[model samples]
Target chain A: MSTARANRMTPYLFLAPAGIVLAVALFYPICYMIYASFLDWNPSQRIGEADFIGLRNYTKLFSDAAFRESMWVTIKFSMVVVTIEMILGVGLALLLDRNIRGMSVLRTLFILPMMIAPIVVGLMWRYMYHPTVGIFNRTLTDWGFDPIPWLADGDWAFASVVIADVWQWTPFIFILSLAALQSLPASAIEASKIDGATGWQQIIYIKLPLMLPVLIVTLLLRLIDSFKVLEVILVMTNGGPGLSTEILSLRINRTASEFRELGEAAAMSNLLLIVLLILTFTMFIYNKAQDARMARLRKVEEEV
Target chain B: MSDKTYDRQNPAFYALLIALVVMAIGPIYLMLATSLKLNVDIMSDSSSLLFMPTLRNYETALCDFLWYEPEHLRRCDPTFGRALVNSLVIGLVSTAITLVIGTMAAYALVRFRFMGRDVVSLWTLMMRMVPPAVLLVPVFGIWTFQFGIDGSRGGIVLVYVALNLPFVIWILQSFIVQVPIQLEEAARMDGAGPFQVFFLVVLPLIKPGIAAASIFTFRVAWNEFLLANALADRNSRTVPVTIVNSLTEFDIDWGVIMATGMLLAIPPIIFTFVASRQIITGMTAGAVKG
Candidate 1:
């Protein structure tokens, strides 16, 4: 081959391994799951032996109350966690966006929660939320107050999982928001300040608007992630306090393992997959829009 | 007086910020404090902020047979030491593999104008968007069936690489694009082979990018739980898996779990502290600029 031809082929050569892996490991599994979702699959039955139900599983799931509850729990959980995390995260980023000694250390410390293994985080928070011995109740007792049921009560169990999730993942938003904040054009904010805009006013009118794109992407990313969350809640509550904390992933786990309804679980996963697909599609479209906008701006600059 | 005036002007803002920070980090602080307290102390004053602190929890966690059955002589509790080692091995090895393979792919994507380039890039991006849950059942089936690689560290490592490859490729590709191709062209003109040019010229040029990618991969693998739980049996259990298994509501040991959490958080926390600036800059350079 000519040198140019060889050079052009080099990328394809390098990309082969990853391509094969993705094709086999990713696409194949997804196809298998999709195929399996069509079957009356039980744990014992092989794919070949299983009767192909042809959307029966999906149809069954629509009327399943437990599955519906799980979906509701997932939606509620994602909404609550993402909303609170965004608020706290953006709020924290705004607060910490300043030059000071040890600020980097403080910022690193702030994001520490996101670094620990989710299972470890779940275990850690579980310990801290222990009814009789956890630090929350311990501290409350020290203050001469009655210890509230943290994990036993259904509502509290849901809130407990949300708290642990927010604790671990809010840092994701914090770092992204902080980066967005730092990247905002300084002069715009400086001009706003000079125009008698208060800090809050500047943040509202200038900073937030500038950071909106990053925030939206980050929000979508977090939402997508929160939808798939399983390990922490599994480790912490095991979807306990009578299914109060059972998010979709947990429900899928239990359905497959505990209920031994592999087909049902697969169907539920397909539902979750659809929800995520919508979110992912929205994000993809949003990203394309932003990229197109940037390309237009670049073209304008080139013309200038 | 000027300082006082400034303080007065920013009072509520500063207060709100401080309160938010405290709220954000409150549970972690509580975990740390609880990790240092004795079980008796922890249990006795479940609501008490004022406890005589002790290192007994850490001591018991690290030294004592908290989960030992005396008659059986089998340590039923998962050892934090073993889990740590497993995590480090899996994280480091997978990260190294990812770096090598991902960099090569990224370099190709950035430099080569070839057929299916857009499709390749799109494939890589879509890999990242594939949620772990979607793959778990299928992967579990595949690993258990095809390879008989059930619950092995190697199996988990392979899955981690698959999970992390797209991210590494995307990030490294951006960095590789920032590297000028003219240098490689010059190296080629000097009769350097592709391998020589890559290793001697381009590799050193993207060391920081590689470092950032490597560290990010390491963090992801280290913090990963789902695949580890799915793939690794007790013999190859990672820190996260061990910690999860430790949480037994019927006969819970809060202190040991807290101690394990503290231990699990240490590596990544230390990593963040050591490379905070590099991480911040590297992450933004790839993410924000794109």
Candidate 2:
């Protein structure tokens, strides 16, 4: 009886430490954030002393032009970056799906940009974008062309940050899509070839359809990450020249730290969290539907 | 899959590959080159590649660690050195703690049929999407007023472990699921308890998973700046926080800063080269599995 009791308790005992930590550190904080969002809170005052000005922060944020601009910038940044990365990454994956020597070496080299600290990535780009001393401008001047203000002009700063992000993260999609492409059941492709399908046709008709699931998940994951991007942009432009490069994360940081408006920052965080949750749930639903389809297919196979 | 046979490629194809490789490594090469060059070389519009290298920047960044003071140094700023130590301690300790509890929790979820496992799964998935920025406000508030653990390494470690645990558990669960049940049963038959079976049998089988998880955990803990910026005081600043703090200066030391940036980049770079396969595996498992 005691042994049975011990056996029943084993999982809980195993789970207890992690559960306790997550509850105190993650779950509690999230709850606190949601509650704090409704209050007129600031960094100087304790949470208890803050006025319970319900929905004012949210209302103020909607009316606030700066917050709206930051949201638009965040959305614009995510869209541009993810779209460009997806195209370049998936295109490269398709192009290089063949067996080649030094592929591992290539992969190792590719991941270096991503594996390095984002701060370092920002630093590298900042140096490369340095107006007078930068590589791009230096080359342009060498060619007798005018130097482009990479991070100085508003439009160029957005483009420059986008370029930096693409450089760092394109490899992520490349590697994933490559894995997806490589893992594709070869028999389907073989059958397609036997049916006189060309390389392009094979990619479009067969390979792409099979890789769709992985691609969607990768896209969503990248979307979530792009929203979370802060350090690189913070280091690069500090959301400056104007509000041109100020994404939501940077705005949130500035709000809490610079503006000292804790409640507004919390509200901004909640809004960002909601957007992410939608993406996450979409992915989750897709996974569930896929799992169900797989189960049903397996059941049919077993029956057959 | 006799796909191992190499394909014949056009010369243009190889040229394209070379171009791609250059595009990938160019900025990193520039950073390394810049870090090696003197301020004079960096400032001068000489030919890009022909400069005598120097370790002066590295010496300047790591001045506190050097036994003998170099002749060029006037005043040594100890911030980078101290930040480096704080980063390592916080990263390693948090990774260790996260892996320990994370593995156990994952094992439990996998090996035992527990109520609320679905709930746990949903929670983990939800938690994974909560950006560090979102946590900045609440974490700052709670750490400051409620926990009183603000401005300490332990506080930073606590948040990191929490932030990383969901992913670690989610990843390790898949690995633990693949551990053959009969092996654990055989161990149990030989008078081993549950913990013994877990530690001795299941743990050894999942070394690759653990390696992958640790790299990711350590990467996040090491690279994270936002929360660390909020949580860490001057004395407890990580490399990322210190680097950001220094960026706000009127006149920047590009060479020394690049050296500091290079130092921060070194571990992850090493990890990538050493375990590129495992890192790729972890990444694929993360997105592809989801």
In TM-score terms, which candidate is top?
A: 2
Instruction: List, residue by residue over B1-290, the lDDT tens digit for candidate 1.
Output: 12322223356766765775686667777788877766676667344577787666565545533443334224443366667778989999999888888888887777765645556555665667777777766677777776778788888888888888888887777777777888999999999877678889988988878877887889888988776877888778888877776665467667667877887778777877788766766556534564
Q: Which 10 successive residues of model 2 chain A have the least lDDT summed? A: A282-291
Model 1 agreement with the true structure over A117-191: per-residue lDDT tens digits: 677677777777877667677778778999989888999999889988987888778888898988889899989
Error of 2 at A264 (Å): 0.3
Q: Candidate 2 has which clashing residue pairs, if any?
A: none
TM per candidate: 0.89, 0.98
Give candidate 2 regions above 4 Å deviation.
B1-4
DockQ values, each candidate: 0.44, 0.85
Query: Cα RMSDs of all predictions?
Result: 4.1, 1.2
Candidate 2 docking classification: high
